[model samples]
Target: MFIELDFESDIPIYMQLVHAIIEGIATRELKPGDELPPVRTLAADLGVNMLTVNKAYQHLKQLGFIQIHRKKGAVINSDEMRQADDEFYERLLTSLRPLAMESICRRLTKNQFLTLCSKIFDEIELKGGKC
Candidate 1:
């Protein structure tokens, strides 16, 4: 769970934590039944507020990436994670809509945008990411 943060970025600290944890799970670095550091401890290590870590954990749980138990705290979900549903796909498209618009506004061709996406996808795939 070595989550690096870019305080300089506009992305919220909580989101950074969320993305890092998701990436770790995707890459198989954090396997099923793995216990994550408690929110307070992880926040201290990351120099972020405990609330930020708490928010990340909650989001992860909702996304089915992790499960939070009363005593067990946060643990990665089962190895057989659920497949994305229609709602998830719709949300994914909604999230990417703005980026697609931005690319077009910048005069990027569809091929260029797709190429960039493919490059990033390959980068993550090489790291054992399931995404």
Candidate 2:
């Protein structure tokens, strides 16, 4: 419900909402089994269209981040977030390939790129940040 959207961003509004929720989960701001606001209520609160919120919620559901129950609405899944599968790994590579190529094209070495990634991961502190 605290998700913020930048309408001017190149990223789609729904995806931004998805990212915010994921961040919340990762940062432990949203604990397992926590309930999210109802779609209409959240849309009203965020000043976004209902469909936008619905789309974001649907995406989260597909990723196993949240489960929709008739009585509970959208509640975070109980500490069983979907693990990255082979397809997910392939997609991850597909997404990173262009970025790697771009770095090479810009005359950055492999070590430089790896170092940058290492620094980012270190800053994120993935282990400590997990929900």
**Model 2 TM-score, all chains together:** 0.84
What does each candidate score in C-alpha RMSD?
Answer: 1.2, 2.1
For each candidate, what is the lDDT? 0.90, 0.88
Per model, state how many residue pairs clash.
0, 0
* Highest lDDT model number: 1
The regions of model 1 sitting more than 4 angstroms off are none
Steric clash pairs (candidate 2):
none
Model 1 vs truth, CA RMSD: 1.2
Cα lDDT of model 2 by residue, 59-116, tens digit: 9998889999999999988966667899879988998899899999999999999999
Index of the highest-TM-score prediction: 1
Q: How well does each candidate superpose onto the true structure, as a TM-score?
A: 0.95, 0.84
Per-residue lDDT over 1-131 for candidate 1, one digit per residue giving the tens place of the 0 to 100 score: 68899999999999998999988887778888999999999989999999999999999998888999999899999758888889899999998899999999999999999999999878778889883
